[model samples]
Target: MSEINLTIDGRQVKAEPGMTVLEVARREGIDIPTLCHHEKLEAFGGCRLCMVEVESRGRTSYAVSCLYPVAPDIAVRTRSEKVDKIRKLLVEELMAHAPDAPELVTLAREYGADRNRFAREASFCVLCGLCVRYCDEVKKKNAVSFFDNGAVRQIKFVPEVAKNECWNCQECFAICPTSYAQAAYLLTEALAFPGQHQSVKRATKAAARKRVVIPIAPVPMTA
Candidate 1:
């Protein structure tokens, strides 16, 4: 494939045809925030926070950097007035779900997004799909996925798969932007699969039944 040259934030860079705009911009040390895009996984534009202004053939538009491909001879602006406004709205929207998320808070500061702009519907999940995508794409474990549709959608673990898989492997927990995947999994473990590992649960309950550690004060000093 021929080299693709593009201008990102006024810096000229050469990239391969398959590389997306976000990859090219990152190659040039450009900072583009994204909650969904992961290097190990395929480009998922679930979070439009990485939107950027693109000018091609005198036409200007915004595109999600993680999913949008780099076009030869196109000018890309990572930050712009319109782009910032769009990002600010996005931040505000996502913050509605995960108000206290560190990543969202940081983005709120940068984009001047007011967390309270929308009604407080704190589910503590921004639905970035980081955890779900990582679980499926990288770990190859379809243990968790988005449950429901529309406004009530949330991530959930398949009780059977989670019972056998999640306890030993929690790789998705670290990648979650809102830190809700862990808690969601725990909740699912509690309610979704009641009889899963009953013996283990019973043993844990039995162990918790008031065992006083009797301290023997210095067992009779050496003869």
Candidate 2:
């Protein structure tokens, strides 16, 4: 594996030939903010939070560092004022859609996003596709996917069937970048209440009673 020399934040750094800009920056102790870029999964480039200005041969352009491979003589600026402003706006927009997501709200605060200037909408998924990618690429379940068009698209689990394709693996719940799936489940549990499963509750009480018998012959056996 050949190495490539690059300049990041005016500091010289070297990385392997095929390393992404994010990888190189982390190695060099340069912080490049990211949201949808997990180390275990392939870069999906949906959040656009890791955008950085790259210069090569006098050509400068913004690129998502998570997807841009490092190259020799490449120059990268990760924390320019321009990059900060754009990231703040992107965080605000994402928050407006999912206001209840605490992770998104915290990220917005970190980027200095003081206000969400966009209108709110009813949406659970941030469209990061962490769930879909994990299920298909890592878990090999293929039990869920994204569907629909335009503003209506979302991640959906496979239709219920005899095989129980979902397997209740909760991969999507674990991989959700926004924590929306877990929050939704918490809300559902709150709404469903304890009385929803009356039969199960009765059976549990009966089983507890059967396990609590007072053995009359226990003292004789001990003697």
By TM-score, how accurate is candidate 1?
Answer: 0.84
What local lDDT score does residue 214 receive in model 2, on the 0 to 100 scale? 13
Candidate 1 stretches greater than 4 Å from native = 149-151, 192-223
- Give a tens-digit lDDT track for model 1, residues 90-159: 9999887777788989999988999999987656777788888888888888888877656576666676
Q: Worst 10-residue stretch by lDDT in candidate 2?
A: 214-223
Best by TM-score: 1
Residue 57, model 2, lDDT: 90
Which 10 consecutive residues of model 1 have the lowest summed lDDT? Answer: 210-219
Candidate 2, 1-223: lDDT as tens digits: 7778899999998898878999999888888877677778898899898899999999998999999999889899998888889899988887766665566777677787854578765454677878778777887876556677576766554432201433356666766765554443332332233454763454345323322111111111110
Provide the global lDDT of candidate 2 against the true structure. Answer: 0.68
